[model samples]
Target: MSVTTKTDGAGDSALVFEQRIQDLCHDELFEQGTGSEVAYDLISNELLLDGSARLNLATFVTTWMPPPAGALMAKTADKNM
Candidate 1:
């Protein structure tokens, strides 16, 4: 998922906030780990202030998974043989 920010119209503050979120998502500790639940909880509790607003961070993490096309096919082939 790509997050686009309108830097010119929103001003520097918005740009910085967006950048921080992007950085957090791309952090090494988060990248090489399976902590979607943890990440989701953290974001929901800390960043999402509005009680009515709901965000699903798990969906974001799943976007980064390796495609199952060829991998699953190969596994099935092995099982059949």
Candidate 2:
């Protein structure tokens, strides 16, 4: 699969997944950049396996926040540290 990177209005980069591809292919051995690609694939798949964040409540804190709110919280957390 061809890897496509997306940029938001704010110029933040993100990955665009056309299909579910494992970051690491068990059949093939790892080579330099391939290993990292495999890892990214795995992480992306796991986070997106479920339909939506609201539907999944498996975490300790299932409270969902909008992206802006989450970003603000992340900044606040960083300041406290």
The candidate that wins on lDDT is: 2
Q: Rate residue 35 of model 2 by lDDT.
A: 38
In order, candidate lDDTs are 0.46, 0.52
**Which runs in model 2 stand beyond 4 Å of their true positions?**
1-34, 54-81
Cα displacement (Å) at residue 60, model 2: 22
- TM-score per candidate, chains pooled: 0.21, 0.23
Pick out the ten consecutive residues of candidate 1 with the lowest summed lDDT: 5-14
Tens digit of per-residue lDDT, candidate 1, span 1-81: 659633333233333335444435543454343244545555666644542212534324544446675577467754433
How many clashing residue pairs appear in each of the predictions shown? 0, 2
Q: Which candidate achieves the best TM-score against the true structure?
A: 2
What TM value does model 2 have? 0.23
